[model samples]
Target chain A: MKRILFAFIVVLVSVSFAKNASAQSEEELVQICGMIAKDATFLKDFRIKLDAGDPPPVQRVPVILKKDVKYRFSVCNSKDFEGKVVLQLFDNNRMLATTYVIATGKDYPTIDWVCTKTGAYHLFFSFRDGKAGLAVGLLSMVEMM
Target chain B: MSRRLLYILLVLVVTASVSSCKSCSNSDDLSQDLVVPDSIAFNDPVPVLGETVIEEMMQNIASPVETAALIKGLKVPFNKDFLLTTKASEKFNTSFEKSLALGIYGCDLGYLNMYEKSSFVIDYIQVIKRLADDIQVGQFFDFSTLKRLATNNENLDSLVTISQQSFSRIDNYLRESNRPMLSAVIVAGLWVEGSYLTTRVAQVSNHKRIRETLGEQKTILIFLLKVLKVYEKDPSMAKFLTDIEKVKALYDDVKITYEVGEPEMVEEDGVIVFKQTDKQIVEMSDETYQKIIDSIQKLRADLTKF
Candidate 1:
């Protein structure tokens, strides 16, 4: 009887700890969004679709460069939806270069771009439907790598 | 009594375990609620146009008289005489120079704004590349000289280049961060300023002259409205559009005052002083001036996000 009681107490403690950890992970994702929104360099737009079943469509922003430039990007996903985001970069006319960002803990997956052409480009982010959410951070483009 | 106590203890432990299991199951729900969604639906992709083709088109579109008026409304003292003569007046000079710089900057910035918007519209409407080409040409301005001037000094050039490059970097950051809407807002903001300039120039000029020079105010307004309509669909642009509306109202008020009455004829002292309500006109001009200043400050604040 004492052994069963001891096991009960242990399980309860672990469960509480798990809940706290989950909450922390969720909070971190929100914090990432806040940080990105506050950044002065990158323009930002976000949308949330409440319904389920359909994979959320990737939002594409076209960039025109007068000169060739290199770029870097990072994306972080919530713990509940880690390993769900796929980042894609396109050069001018829909040429897809796929990059994967594996969300571990709260860290964003990062990608680098060495743009060789002076033309239009599109950046795409694909996330898992329903279970996962994403936050993009640390986007930079410069003439030099 | 012992049996009863043992049963109660077992019941308590079982109940506690069940509750804990239930809580663990609910954690997923809690986490899901807090999770940021994976993707946001964006407007369709905009068709891309070649830079050379776009440049050629803009050259064909002659400078409208409204363009000059809009430049004047910005109150940039671009004339070398105005800048040199006014140096002694620090307050006036500083204000004039800043407005001028911003006006120039705004024009350069308008290129990107028009590009993104026209591209988006083209993509969504599946319009032909020629239409996109036309719109792009209509909006393009040659900034080669300005870029050279801004970057003339080695030290200043590096700084200016850095600042301009930062825009692209920041744009990349937003894209990576799953906040394309914010970027879109920034782009839309540039368009709003451009549209405002177009509208201001069109309305402030004499109707007959404007019609002769730049077609009509209605045509310009329609073009601007189309741009605004595309931006209005995005959630992030709501505040920006509101700001644009405020400026538009001020412009309308200025127009109403200017067109309210018939031209009055007044004779003064010895000269045939046509009863021109010049004073009233000046006051109205001052009001419009204040509105422009307020709008610039508001725009700067909105742009701080980028």
Candidate 2:
């Protein structure tokens, strides 16, 4: 009887704590996504949640990019894991731009690329050191001057 | 009682407690008895539109900002008559109509916000909430917060952003969570209404940019039709598909050709950027443009009315 009671208590407490933790993290990511989009004129980001684990999977979003349009892509994650995730833009196997670099100390937070060719392009994202985190990718047009 | 009998009693108590707690939470979510469809039968999974097609299609949306900016630049008078009526809110009783109406009013909300018409914004917010509530996605919108924002003209940008975010969040949830039928219907509502608003403006203004902007909706409609086709098995969706097919046929002859231009390096907000130079030329004759406008107007009027 005592063993069952103890097991029930543990399970109840674990579920409660897990629920709160998940809610807080999800809430924080949503706030960050809104902040990133506030000033963007054209690009609206699709807020996505990712977890870090072994055999890290990159968050890949594929879309068609039109020729002769300047698209600006920016990312903002939870402060706990800022500068810890890398975001890359790809066309087929060709790497277009990314947010992080080693030994260069140049982490471009937002990547601005002009699609010179009209075709399919990909935005790939993954966390460094398998650190699970929440992130938002914002896309917009460079103002026509 | 025997030990086994006592154990069974304990298990029953625990299960009953958990079930009661879940019901309590569900009730607390919304006071209104929303007909949120719990069992939407589907024959197949929502097909993925070949890599990032959704993401690309999202960006390809006919932004009210562009439409509003052009209308402002042209100094066109704001026409309230062009908007859908509030009385139509009660007509959306089913999940299909409710979801589609939410998107339908979403276009009006954007158009009203962009034109800086603050007075009537809250009315539409209420309609959106009622429709969203009917669809059971009311949780995505903070109604009181949106109502407050709509009343203040200063928050027009925030209002637009919040509403857009709300729609985006719902779209992302439905698509990623494998509920693409609802997503498709909502998107179709938004497009039909948005294109309707743009075409309404184009009818009165001879500006090439507005006409060109409205013409570009052909691309968006093509993508939207592609998404809806995935859910063609649904009976209501089957009916909706026929309407969309009519719009596509009307847009069939409108040609949009892009000419490649060199990338230009420019500095914006102290950051150097490469701007794409390719310009789109929409070869739309007066008759084609007029037909497109007439088709969209008729389609939207019918959809919003019935």
Candidate 3:
């Protein structure tokens, strides 16, 4: 009887902590969404949350990009999240642009791409080092060429 | 008493396992509520467009602000005559009508912001707020802040950013709430108004870029039609489907071929930038372009009518 009672108490405490953690992550994302450049028009935002494990899980978002348009992609990580974000733009199976450079082990907060082809494009978001994190990716139109 | 405690333990364990996974599925299962047919009852589940496809189509719809900015760049004069009157907002009785009008006003707001027409923006914003409220998505719009930004010329950029963000929030909320049908309608409204503005501008200006941009709508139209078809089970959607399909038929002749080129990557300002090398070639004769323009104009007219 005592063992069952202890297990129930443990479960209750875990649920409480989990709920608070999720809420804080959301609040962190909302607070940092205003970091777009002055000349750019905010188009959309993609919010991602992944569990920590080997080979961080990726979230894919499909978007249409027009030819001759300059677009900016920026990402913000939650303050409590240990993992940094890696945002990549892809054309079908071909990876086009990414925020993380594997050679130098560096990550950028933003990427600027000038699209020459008008079609469906995908955005893949994940974290470095297989770490659990919460992040938001912002897509903005920088210019039209 | 011991057996009761064990039962409680099992229930608690199951509850904790289910509730503790904070990062689970991101999308709600909207197919059952949204895609079910009203005319006939079926024991087996009916397969329809997945929520992810709907989301992609939603995100892919071109923003009105981008088109308006292009018009501004082209030095085209801001013509208030092209805008739908705010009075039309009151005429929309159904959720479909109100949502579509909400999208139209959203585009018009974008145009007003792009042209820096501060005087006419407040009226549109007010109507948008009313329409959004009717659809239960008005909470996304921060009216006081938007009005404050609209009234000040120095805050035009901020006004544009906030307004666009508000629409994005509404889109997210609708998808999350299993109301993607309304969300799809809203985007259709935005696209129609945007295409109308472009075609109208194309009539007078000999701008090659504008014509190319207008021609590219062929692809977007196909995507929009596909998304709308998934929601055709709704009684209110038949008229919308018909009108949009007519527009799609008109876009059939628009030829958009591409030229493949070598992709380039360069480091600019310490950032790795990849410039897409393939070029899009939009080929449309004057006659085909004119037919598309007429079709779009009529469609927009029908949609805006009470």
Top DockQ model: 3
lDDT of 1 by residue, B87-161 (tens): 221221221122222223333332222222222221211111122112221111223432443334333322222
**CAPRI-style class, candidate 2:** acceptable
Clashing residue pairs found in predicted model 3: none
Cα misplacement distance, residue B276 of candidate 3 (Å): 1.1
Candidate 3 interface RMSD after superposing interface residues: 5.3
Candidate 1, which CAPRI tier? incorrect
lDDT, model 1: 0.36
Indicate whether candidate 1 or candidate 3 has the larger TM-score. Answer: 3
Model 2 DockQ vs. reference = 0.26
What TM-score does each of the candidates earn? 0.31, 0.75, 0.83
The list of candidate 1 runs beyond 4 A from truth reads A1-8, A23-69, A76-84, A91-93, A100-109, A114-121, A127-138, A143-145, B1-227, B230-306
TM-scores of chain B, in order = 0.30, 0.80, 0.82
CA lDDT of every candidate? 0.36, 0.67, 0.80
Kindly report the interface RMSD of candidate 2, rounded to 1 decimal: 6.1
Ranking by TM-score: 3, 2, 1
Number of the top TM-score candidate: 3
Model 2 lDDT, residue B287, Cα: 86
True-contact fraction per candidate equals: 0.03, 0.12, 0.57
lDDT of 3 by residue, B1-306 (tens): 878877877777677767655243322222223432332232334234466665465475768877798888899998999899998788887788888898899999999999889889999999999888777777778788989877776678888888988898888877776677778889889999999999889887989988888889887877777778877767667778977888788777888898876667788866567788887899988998888889989989888876
